[model samples]
Target: MSRGLLFRLVAIVVVSLVFPLAFTAYGLYSGARVERLALEERERQMQRVLGEVSAGLREINSGGKNGDALDREVRGVLNRTLAGYPGIRGGVFLPETQRTVIGGELKWYDYRPEVWPKEGRELFRERDPVIREALDTGEAVTRRIVMYRGEGLVHALPVTVGGEKAVAWAEEVLQPAIGQDRVLRKWAFLLTTMGFLVALASALYISGSLGRGVNRIKNGLEQLKRDLSYRLPPMPGELGQIVAAINQLAQGLMEKERLEEQLQRSARLAALGHLTAGVAHEMRNPLGIIRGTAQIMAQEYNHVPGLAEDVAVILEQADRQNRVIRELLDFARPAPPLMQEINLNAILESVLSFSRKFLEQNQVNLVTQLSPDLPQVQADGEKIKQVFLNLLLNAVEAMPTGGTITIETLATPDGVAVSFGDTGPGISPEARSHLFDPFYTTKSDGTGLGLAICHQIVTMHGGNIEVETGDRGSVFRVSLPRSPERRDAGGTLDPGD
Candidate 1:
């Protein structure tokens, strides 16, 4: 697995576990802290309550002072408080003596003073330091104790009557501090869960990054398999090194391909050369014999019936064979092209004339829109003539049905333009792509070097030829750069084979 991917997955797992767990722990700890604070507050409030009761009592019952209605109201407040606070451990409230006991022996039990203890405030079990301090001050006592039931806090306050005498005390018990602890537990769990998830997400993200890089490499490889011509994208990091290596491998394969092509071409050319040499050698003797015999028959049968015509046919056949050999030789060892400043218009017109007979034979129409004033282009006139003738002838041949061949020209500051458009079937895409490739031809008896040679000659002239074809037929655009010194808008010239 890639490092990024590994990091992401591990991060996911870790977050899944750590967030919930740590949140729970933190929640628990916080809950405990809140619980303690709540307990402390409860104790302080208890102390305040006690002080209020005791002070109220002392105002009325100080120095053993008492009142009947005050006793009734005090009893009512105690009853209500005890009822509201179920956790409270009840204690005496006096309006006569200023004494508040948080935890102590009751002055009376079962309707009578029982188990009364001296200094009852000190006698109670002290559970918290604040409560002890409150008692010593004779103000109030707030403390926690497990005297009668479950753990609880005590709040007590002193009361005085008149101006200077202690009167009574009020005491109340509060619930324990543990309830708030539960909330903390929940919070801690939440925080831990969030933290864990964050970590896990990070890991997952890293892993995905790694996986993405690998996927790119895989896709690049697949595309290479489909099209060897396609180049792969540059990979990142060490993977870049891998891509570089793959590129090297592809280059090696391309070299091998070139070598194979060269080998195949060489092999075919060798076979063709051998066959042509042998055939030409073999036919030469027969051709010479036939020529000599034809001459003798022409002379001897001059006054004979129609033997002269027969002799002529024989001679023509022999000569045609010899011409075919000459064509082969021309293909094998072509003459070097001689370059000159030739007018394209004349060349195009000459080809048109040559194919004019064919065009007439096929009942095809010929049209010319040659530029009025064209520049003389530097080229091998003979080869340019051949290119023009071949193309015109092909166009004429294509439209066995009567059609028009249109030739046009355009002159520009940059170059000379000649356009040949034929109202025949347009060039097929598959064949057009390789039209200039040697041996790639649509016609059955075609040597297939015509367009290739045209391309070579045009290129030699420092020009380019382009073709566009569709349902509207085919058009060839030939562009030749204008000569440096000699410039003519467009003009005419005589061209020949």
Candidate 2:
């Protein structure tokens, strides 16, 4: 795994855990905060209820109301105060006469002893310290209260009825905070789950993307290692740049290998040329002397019985030796091509005309598909013609019993392409490897310089020659530059046989 991918996965995992937990923690804190605020609001509502009750008691005392009329007025005041604030569930008034006046929505709970706490009912019935403190100090007091049904806030205020202490109280019952907590918990879980799922999916997607990029690069390297010709597909972003670099490296390696092979071949050819130069020089004089001696003997012994055949044999062998020596000399030191613009189709026609009789005698079929608009190539006319002739003769010879030789000419993007396809036994892989090597031959009587010379001529013209062989046949493709400018643009040429 790549470091970047590993780090991203780790980050994703951390976020998946940390963010959700943080959200839950925030929810818990917020829930507590909200409950506190709600409790405070309830306390304020209780205070408001207490304030209204105290004002009503003061008015009743000031008006000198008494008995049933006073009780009715007090009850009406408590009811009106509690009704003004919905949170104030109940209100109780402890008058100087010791009669209790209670009002509000939770008044029924006071009668229902099962749900109401005994201590809470006692506090409302009798004067508790919270109420006593308010009555004794003539001040307001507030307390938080919890019972069976829910929680509440109680407010007690001292009311002076003509300077006599009376307690005015209000209790606000709040909805259960547990329900709010449960809601918060439910939301927290939902949010955390959603956050974690999103994090996991994002992490997988990012990790897989990085892994795929790395794998593609790895696979490309492996392919190039197996076959230098392998090319990478186009990619995007930094990976694309990396892939481009790898492809370039592969290209460089391939070019280097080709150059090394060419250097080795050139070295061998140079050494062979030097050796053949000396050997051919040494053998030529002897071969000429032998031929001259045989001719003299033939002339001197023309009347000698059975001497004619022997002299003829000597002459034939010397001629063969001279041909071999000439081929060597040609291979050792080839003359520079006399560059000129020449029509390749015209030259092919002429060579074909000359080879017609030879091809016919060998029972070989010759087929030419010469292009009509074949562009002229900047090359030595005689050298290019010799290349064509050598290729045709090879094809003719390969098909000993008889086969077809297909010659095709067509225009190419960079130049012109000439293909010579022969229906013959394909060259063996082992022989094909060293087919252009000096003195390498498949035939016993071959000089082996034929294809080498052809390769030489094409190379001098700044062109390429490639051969494809299989069980069916072999195709020799020759690509030549369209003009001198095209050839010269390709830089220097390789010196060859």
Candidate 3:
């Protein structure tokens, strides 16, 4: 399976964390190794210096030397040996008399001039432990200590001085690598901490961003399950592309479902057309004959009061039946429209003028918002007027007591549009679905062919009729193309085709 965004995000975080840790580990390891090696080399150098001083002390000639001469000779040996090494100082400690002797010319000594001991007994008292350890053990003892001039190494070796036990000790200031290593360790720790924190912050930020994007996608998918019309919002990088693809897929699915519904509607309408044609042919002749007979009887029996009333009822019923037949025929085989360029606003104004008295009688207030720059469309003015009139009457009937009907004409991208909005109880979802279907009417006395015919006429003219309804009211919009292409020699266009 392909890796998901979660996996990629985790991988990114892991890699981000690993790099700094690896770098820190390597830095610490390399730094410690270098520091250790430098320290070991310094210790070796101090050992060599101490070894040379020890040999030089053994070579000192004290056959007839008095105490002052021996002291001067030993001081000369220490100064000569220590002078050979920069930043090195040496001293001898006699555990028997507790006397310490330091080279006077060695400026690298830890003590200041004021702190320097004038009494030999008080000098090098701190070295007593190390010197005694070396004299007792009869072996060299070495120690590393921090001094005034950085880190230094001190070595004490047991020796026989004037046939008495003593400790010859040497001290040397280590190379500056020891101090540099300390600084390096401090900086490395600080830098590693900072790097780790930065990595953690970056990981959290990236993960949060990715998580939000993924959550959006997830929520979008859930919405799609409930509503195919739902579209994914814009995102960045590859996520944006994914959202675009998903939106396209949703659009395609909606189109496919729309086409399927249209196909079903077309098939049903075709069957109804065939049935309507047969029924209208059968009922038309009978309806005409009945009306003719009723008219003759009424003329002959007017002097008979009750007879005339009965004949009038028969004539009215016949006329109503004939109108029904006529409607069916019109629906079954409608004549093609005479397509021409016409202003929709002019047609709407004409329809409004013709229907004003009827609307006033029904107690409906009329409102108009016709766009001055509305475009003309290719349509039949008379048929378009009929459609608008039917919609207006339907709106008036919807509000039984009284309501407002707003008529609007506006310019669309491809053509002109006219809408009729009415303040009445809206069409239900179930009724709305079949509003344009044959013989489906909400009115008690309606033939249910008015809006269906309107839909058919508009469709023939390469136009569309749509409705939007809510609890507040309903709005019916008719959109006609500016220049519709004639589909056949008869100038008829089938929207489905």
Q: Looking at candidate 1, what is the lDDT of residue 317? A: 79
| Model 3: worst 10 consecutive residues (lDDT sum) | 488-497
Rank order (by lDDT, best first): 3, 2, 1
The candidate scoring highest on lDDT is: 3
Off by over 4 Å in 2: 1-188, 259-267, 285-322, 352-371, 392-408, 412-414, 420-433, 442-446, 466-476, 483-497
> Which tens-of-lDDT digit does each residue in 188-217 have in candidate 3?
778877777776677667667777888899
Q: lDDT of each prediction vs. the true structure?
A: 0.61, 0.76, 0.77
Q: What TM-score would each prediction reach against the true structure?
A: 0.43, 0.56, 0.64
User: Model 3, residue 1: what's the lDDT?
Assistant: 12
lDDT of 1 at 32: 69
Candidate 2 local lDDT, 176-281, one digit each (tens): 6556576768787788777777777788887788788898889888978876788999799999999999899889998897678667767777767777878888
Please identify which of the two predictions, 1 or 2, would achieve the higher TM-score against the true structure: 2
Of 1 and 3, which scores higher on lDDT?
A: 3
Which stretches of model 3 miss by more than 4 angstroms?
A: 1-175, 182-199, 222-230, 258-263, 289-318, 360-365, 397-404, 423-433, 468-473, 488-497
- Taking all chains together, the TM-score of candidate 3 against the true structure is 0.64
